[model samples]
Structures are given as C-alpha cells and as structure tokens.
Target chain A: MNISIKRKDQGDHRFLVAVSGEIDVFTAPELQKGLLPLTEIRGGTLILDLNETRYMDSTALGVIVAALKSASRHQCSFSVTGMTPRIQRLFEITGLMELLKRVQTSRGVAND
Target chain B: METQEDESQLSEYRTLLAHYISQKDQKLPTEESEHLRRQLHACGILPEDLLGLHIEALKGAGIFSESAMMRSLNFLMKMMSGYSKAYREHQELKDWQKQLDTELDIASALQKTLLDGKVPACSFADIGAISEPAKRMSGDYYRIVNDGKRLVVTIADIVGKGIPAAMCMSMIKYAMDSLPENSQGAPSYILSLLNRVVERNVDTNMFITMFYGVYDPETGIFSNSSAGHEPGFYYSAREDRFMDLEARGLSLGLAREAEYKEYARRIYSGDMIFLLTDGVTEIRKDHDFIEREQIVALIRRWMHLPAAEIVKQVMRALKKMQDFSLQDDFTFIAIKF
Candidate 1:
C-alpha cells in the first residue's frame, strides 16, 4: 500500500493522507504506522483519501477505528473520503459507519 | 634592508604567486597551511618573501604528508566498516526469517494433529468434514467427541487467519477439553462457558464464530446453538425442501454477558445438516461475493450422496469455480442421517 501524508500549508494543522492498494491483515500495520501519529496531533484535522484502495479487510477497519479513538482523545478531526460502494457496504455491515466520519471529497471541508 | 633590484625581484615573485593562486587547478594550500602562514606574517615575515619556501613545502611534505595519506586510509576503513555492518544486518534478517518459517511449520503440524483427530462413530449420524487453509495454516477448527450416549460436535472460525488465528484455535481446543462432561448436551451452557474462557484469555480485538451441537443416536435428535455463526442449511428428505438453522447470539469473546439461544430438530433418515465457515460462502468473484444460493444449490445437487461424498463433491465444484485458489480458509462439515 502507498500512504502519503501532506500538510495543507505552513500554518494550517490539517493533513491529507492518500492510501492506495489492498489493506488486509498483513498490510494494515503499515497503514496504522502512517495514520496513528496524525491522530495525536492536537487540534488538527486528518482527511483520509481512499479513492484508489481496491480492498480492505476487518483488520484494516480495526486500525481505522483505533485511529478514530486516538483522534477523539487528542481532539483531532478525522474523516474518510471517496470510498467505493463495496467498501461502503462493508463498513455498513460491520457497523463501523456509525463510528467513523465520512466525507464526499478529500478536502473534507463541507459540513456533515 | 634589500637592494632595489632584490625588492623588484620580490615584487615580481609576489605577482607570479598571486596569478598562480587564481588558477583553478593550482592545488591551493589547506586551511592549516594558511593559519601557519598568517602566524609567520604576524611575526614580521613578508608574505611575498615566504612564497617560494611555501611552494617548496607544498611539493615536499605539506600537502603530500603521511597525515594526508592516513586521512584517505581512514575514510576507506570507515567505508569498509559500514559495508560489514550492513552485511551483518542482512545475514541476521535472513536468520530471523528462517527461524520464523521453522516455528510456523511446527505450529501448522500441531494444528493438523489436533484437527484431524478421531471422529465419533455413531449409528444416528454419518459425519464428514474438511478444513483447507488459504495459507500454510488454518484458523478454522472442528471436533466431534462421543460421550458413550450422545455425540458432541463443535465448529469455530477465528476472525483472522495464519499463525495468530492458529494459536487461538489451540486455546479453543484446550478450553473445549476442559469443559465439564455434563455440559456437552447443553449447547448454550457450553458456549457460555467457552465464551468466558475466550473473553478472559484471547485478545479483545479478535473474536470467534462457533456452532455447537449435540446428537442423540437413540432419539435422532439434533440440539444446537450458535455464537454469531453463519446460518447452516438443513435438508429434509421428507419435506423436499431446505431450511435454515438460525440462532441468535453474539460472537464469542465480543461481550462477557452475551447469551446464545438453543434450537432442536429431529433428524429422519436422508436428512442432512450442512455447516460451513464464511470462507465457503464469501468466495470472491470480481468485486462481489459468490451468492449463498449458488452454494446451497450445489449442495442440493449432491444431497442424495453420503455425508463424506457430498462434502467432496461440493468442495470439488467450489474448487473449480474458484480456479483452485481460495482467498481464505475453506471449512465445511456435513452430518447425514
């Protein structure tokens, strides 16, 4: 998987992370390593772009949920964007849609 | 006090030295040489008078000294040390990979021994089961124990696969063994006990889905309970229809106080119960899953055969449909009456 994190600007604390490729039990740890620290940045916003992600398993969902919990503790705003329909169904079936924030685009500027 | 001709010659020498220093490839003096020359100039020696002596020193021993050669030698030594360090790390990584492979092999063997143990011989039911892991080891488990009167059968699938899931299977095996013999007939009680053991021992992130059933040879009664397991199929020869064996419960280890409900049915001759892990039902086709109805239809096509033959035929069909490589472990158990 490829995970790239880009800060919005010099003064802005918001970060945009784009993830691509499969995220299964074996590869979720790499995603977690890239995402977990962003959750701890106080008062920051994290926008995860999963437009290119073809597949993800339950372990990957767990990693995302863990990041959400950490983001909550640090008062960071976290949202996921551009999920495929199949991926959306998986999130709904696992009942993770209720826990995670979803947005329409990578910018995540629109109000929910 | 120099003569006019000697002073003129010295001025000419200074001009030549300045011109030489301006040339790119002249190999200028190092900072150390400049420092020494400055100290000499401060002590009242003219820079122009020292130019010829400095040139001679540079040619003889200053820039080409033993210390300069030692510096180059030291750099080569450092490069060699770095290479050796990288080589050692590569060898250590290879050794670690070898060690992990061996350990996984041993664990896989032990898991096979536990799973392929003797199945109970009962007149009321003929059972056949198979567990095929997608990787080197499986996370699926099944065991049938005969307690002289009734036979107890249990099948479970851990949420993950490979070594960690195999380890959880081992923990489940021991926990099953430790259950009281009296609890074998009560599926809910058995699952509740197992849930406590799993909740206490297994990692919270992981959970297991299980189906536990007890069969009585004398009465042809099959009582079963489920812990968030997939709903198995029940084919009745008399009714000529398939029924779903559904129960309500949370997956094991999800919650400490989760309760499982029991269901019972009488098995007549030619009746069969088909139990399977999600691996069989959730086969991937492009971006979608192979429909469960397709699997049920495949079972119906071979419903007339014995339990073992039915399992074999269904697995063969699935293998052909999947192009012989499953994405996850495939486990199925069939009980024919």
Candidate 2:
C-alpha cells in the first residue's frame, strides 16, 4: 500500500533507483512515475534496486515490464538488482528473470 | 398460486405432499414426481417454499406430531444462522474462499467432474489440460469436449466464489454440452447463448469470464471467442514467435445481449493455442507474483515437449513459484497443432 522511491545519479546520466515498501495495485502508479522517465536515459544506465521492496503485485510488475521495454526501444542500458527471494520468485514466475539474465549476459559481453 | 393451472398442480401437490408427509413408507411415482417438479419450476416455486406452508397446514389438522416438526424447524434455523454468519465473515474479511456447507461440497464434486473430462484424440491437434482449486471449492472451471469432428475447450472464472459460483459453472457445463458444436464460427454463438443464461438466472452481483475455442483439423484453423477473458497466445511455428489470440466481449451476465467476436488463425505445424484462468498469472507470493510473460516463457521452453507435458511443467513451475500453496484456482489448456 505504501512505497518509497529514491533516485540517485551516478553521473554521466547513470541513475540508480532504490524502491522500498509494498507496491500493490494501489501504489503501482507511483512506481511508474519514478521508473519510466529514467528508462529513456539514452546512452546511460538505469539500475533499479528492489532489496527493500517488501511486496509487489502484477500492476507493479507491469510498470517494470513497460520500463524494460521502453529502455530496449531507446537502446539504453537498464538493469535490476537486490531482489529478495520472495521478489525473485515473482520475477521468476513472470519470465522477467530470464529476460533480465539475457540483458545481463549481453551487457557482460559488450563490456568485455 | 393464482392461475387455474397452478391451482390444479397445487391441489395435486397438496394431495401428494400430505400423503407423503403422513405416510412414512410411501414413494411418489417417478413420472408424477417429475411432473410435480416441472410444474413447480414453471410456477417459479421451489420445493422448500411449499414445505413450510404444507407443514403448518398439517400441524393445524393435527395430522403431524409437533415434536418432529419442531426438531426439523430448529435444525433448518440452525443451518440458516450458520450460513448467515459464514457469509458475513466472508464479506467483512474479503475472504470468499470459505466452502459454506454440503451444497458447496456437492458443487466442488461437480467441478472435479469437469476436470476429469478427457481431451478427444485429434490426429492434427494434441491437447493437454488440468484445473486445480486453491481450496475445497473452486471458482475456476475448464472443460474439454470432443464434438466428434472438432475439439471445443472452455475456461471460465466466476466473479463470486463458493456454492453460487460453482452452481453457475454447472449451468455453463450443461449449456455448453447442449450447443451445436460443429458449426463453423460457432464460438461466438456459444458464448452469446451462455451469456443469456447467466444474465437471466444468476445473481446481479455475479458474472463470469470465459474463453472458448474450437479447433478444426481439416483446415488446421482454430477459431476462438472470448467473454471478457484474458487474451491467450498463439504460437506461429513459421514465424517462431508468439502472438496474442485476440477477441473481445463483456463478461457473461454483465449484459443480457452481450456479443463476442470470433478470431481465427491457421494453426500450422508446431503452432499451439494456450488458454488459462487469471489465477495462473496472478499468483502472488510474499513479495511478488507471476504474470503472462512468465507463463509464455514457460510454454516456449516446453514447446518441443508433448502438449500434455507442457501443461504439466507449467503447472509445476506455477506451484513452485507460489511455494506449493495456491492462492486461487489454477486451470490451463495447451493445444499443439
């Protein structure tokens, strides 16, 4: 029902978003505001931290998926990390984990 | 109660009920009993509606002893109060999962009969399906019926839960069974007929979402229809990607004259149709839940396996995601052509 989102710039247009609290249907809209703009950071990296996120629903997941898709279209680097086991299960069930893994693998290859 | 026909039927029922009430060793003849039931239904009467009044008449006549009637009344009152309390708790707490009584138990049994339906063997299409309830009673219902020439699969979720929801499901099952299944572009027709039934008889607060599809082997075309159900996926083997199987309509019972449109695709080799209830995608653990994309991935990963095996693996993955504890009824069908 409650969510807190803090955005920090890592310079060079790189941003790290730390999200915490419960993100069910009621609060997914708020998450959308904090995450979508950063997704279009063109030539920069967007990292979302869900370590403090205690809960999330399908609506919130949709927001994240939208951000993921938007980032891909913009050709910006996007990454997600710090998922609790519970949150991890959510991603795993949604096939987002596989998508994220593919991105990470591609990013790793590009970096090398 | 006012019509001459009703009066005549009432007199007959009065004679039958009175005799039955007085004599413990007598049985109503089957034809007569069926006629009485049909007449009662036609008169918008339930048997219980007549029983109390009949009992009062018999008591006044001193034909029935007071003790047995008092005991029956007391028992009925007790069950009524129990049901009232259970319903109250259910509403206040947002917990619609409680199985109210023997009626709900019977409804749950009927739901299992739907699950036990066999997928008709099709040389061109292989089908796999299963439905699991989160509790003793399930709001989700799926049935796979072979119409001799084509296979028809129906997946539905009642908006409300418990006995009433299950009863609606039974009505749907029978109604689907009686439909002319072999007609081309009949998926929409089937949903419209079902929608009329739900709108007329079901409670105002209750509605149902259904996805129905008929697969034709000769043309390899699977035409589908939806009644406010989530759109499923159609995997195109040639394209090597999944596409949404799109069709639109209001949920059944929302509007008496609701219309569902048909969507069709030629299911080529390696193509499959995937249909499911929201329970599979909305599964929430402590901090997270699964979604449609995750399910699509599960299917894509298992595409090479047998259709039945693909459905089973998806079920297993969903169970694991929810930590082997379901929060809702899970039912899905995978059809490969």
lDDT of each: 0.72, 0.71
Model 1 spans with C-alpha error above 4 angstroms? A1-23, A30-112, B1-96, B182-185
- DockQ of every predicted complex: 0.13, 0.02
TM-score of 1: 0.64
Task: Provide the lowest-lDDT 10-residue window in model 1 chain B.
Answer: B72-81
- Candidate 1, residues A1-112: lDDT per residue as tens digits? 4433343433467788777787878788788888888888877788878888887765676677667667766777888888998677555543345445431232245424
Residue A49, candidate 2: alpha-carbon lDDT: 93
Question: Best candidate, DockQ-wise?
Answer: 1
Candidate 2 chain A — worst ten consecutive residues by lDDT sum?
A90-99
What's the C-alpha lDDT at position B238 in model 2?
86
* lDDT (tens digit, per residue) of candidate 1 on B150-253: 88888888877788888899999989877765564489988988989887887645777899988887888999998867678888889988888876566676
What is the TM-score (0 to 1) of candidate 2? 0.53
**Cα error of candidate 2 at position B60, Å:** 69
Give all candidate RMSDs, comma-separated.
Answer: 14.6, 21.0
